[model samples]
Target: MHLELAVATDLPALHSLVESAYRGDSARAGWTHEADLLGGQRTDLAALQIMLDDPAQRVLVLRDGDRLDACVALANRGNGTVYVGMVTVAPRLQARGLGRLMLSASEEQAVRLFGATRIEMTVISQRTELIAWYERRGYRLSGERRPFPADDPRFGLPRRDDLEFTVLEKPL
Candidate 1:
């Protein structure tokens, strides 16, 4: 696999890959599915375009030649930290080390390109296994929690009212 910065033309494939990894029945093929907790599209082209237009942000893609297999969004926070979000791996390829490799690539990019000293991300609080996986990679809970955006349809409609995100951080 090779890592590259995603351009605007990659939006459609990126949107589809992320949706398949986390939404609806298709996501059930992988352990990362969030279909039970939320409903609706994982992302849309407009939102992705906004990120692509931002100079402080980069969408890092892992590809096998022209095939986009995984991706993550990195944003330089203007501090010493970079915010990592929207991590996704093709559902069929989950748990096979691709996600880890993508995340590591994001962190490397953070330090090398942004001069970042730390990397941070928010994960759904209910995803214990996912949180543990981050823990194993040196991320620790920072005791911060933010309520899930139930009001935002773009983020998906919550089935339960209890959903929230826990901030996780790691020094680069």
Candidate 2:
């Protein structure tokens, strides 16, 4: 696998990969699917453009040959912390160590580019398996909670009412 910062031309592919990993029937092939709790696009091109335009943010992609297989977004918060999100892996490629590698690369890039002291992320509070995966990688619950954007179609239409985020952090 190869790792690199994603360019504008990669947005569409990245967008599709992310959506396939989180929404729709295609996502059901992977363990990370959130389609059961939400229904709609996982991400849109406009939001991706905004992220690409942010100077403090980096969208990293992991490629197998010429195909984009995984990606994650990292933003330096200017407070010695990097916020990580939108971690996506091709459904068929999930559970093959790609997610772990992509996350590690993102953290390394955060430290290299911004001298980050820690990396933080938010996961759906009810995703026990997902949270455990992060914990195995050294992340710990930070005792913080944020309401899921239920009113935002840009995120997703909540299928269930009990949706919230739990913050997770790891020292870099």
Candidate 3:
């Protein structure tokens, strides 16, 4: 597989890959599926388009031949730290180390583009398995919590009322 920075022109494929990786029936094939907790699309094309157009943010794509296999979004937070999110590997490709590759590439970009040493991400607190995955990747809990936007359909329709985010950080 090859890894590279994503361009605005990649929006459509990226959107489909992301949706399939996190939501819908396709996501259920992977351990990372949020289908049980959220019922709608995790993201939309407009939001992705904005991220692509933002000079301070970058979205990286990993491809296996012509197939888009994984992606992540890194945003410069302007404080020597980068915020990482929207990490998604093709559902069928999960647990095969592609996610790790995309993550490592994001961190390298953080260091190279912004001279950042710290990278932060927020995971839904209820996602124990996902949190553990990040822990194994060198991230530690920050003891910070943010209320998950209940009414934000852009994120997804929450399955439970208690959904919230737990912040995690890693130093590169």
Candidate 4:
């Protein structure tokens, strides 16, 4: 399998893929989606473009020819750390181990691209299954709780008000 950095032309597909993996009925086909917990867009094209433009950030995509299969975003937090987010796999491709492959690749890229020794991410506090998944991958909860951006439409429209984030970290 090959993983490559997403380009400008990939933004639209990235947006659609992320939405399919995180919202609407299409997302329900996947085990890793937030369809029941949220509504609205997962992310906007502008935000994606900004990541593409940033020297310290990258969105890696795994593709089957011209079709996107999976993606993960990483940001160099500096000081030997990188932040991982936006882990996504096509709904049809879920439960087939693609998410794990993508995540492993992301960790490799984090170290390769940024010389990172640690990687971190935030998951919704209510996603127990997801947190367990990460734990199996060696990430531990850092006990840091962050308020979800409930007021930010750029992220999503929360269906509930109790949403919050718990930070998870691992040494690469």
| Candidate rank order under lDDT | 4, 2, 3, 1
List model 2 lDDT by residue over 61-108, tens digit each.
988887899999999898899999998999998999989988989889
Candidate 3 per-residue C-alpha lDDT over 38-80 given as tens digits, one digit per residue, 9 for 90 to 100 = 9898899999999999989999999777778899999999889
Q: Give the worst 10-residue stretch by lDDT in candidate 1.
A: 8-17
Q: Which regions of candidate 2 deviate over 4 angstroms?
A: none
**Model 2 steric clash pairs:** none
lDDT of 1 by residue, 34-137 (tens): 99899997789998999999988999998888789999999999789999998899989998998899889999999988999999999999999999999998
Q: How does residue 77 of candidate 2 score in lDDT?
A: 93
Model 1 lDDT at residue 72? 95
Candidate 3 or 4, higher lDDT? 4
lDDT value, residue 82 of candidate 2: 97
Among residues 3 or more apart in sequence or in different chains, the pairs in candidate 1 whose N, CA or C atoms overlap within 3 Å are none
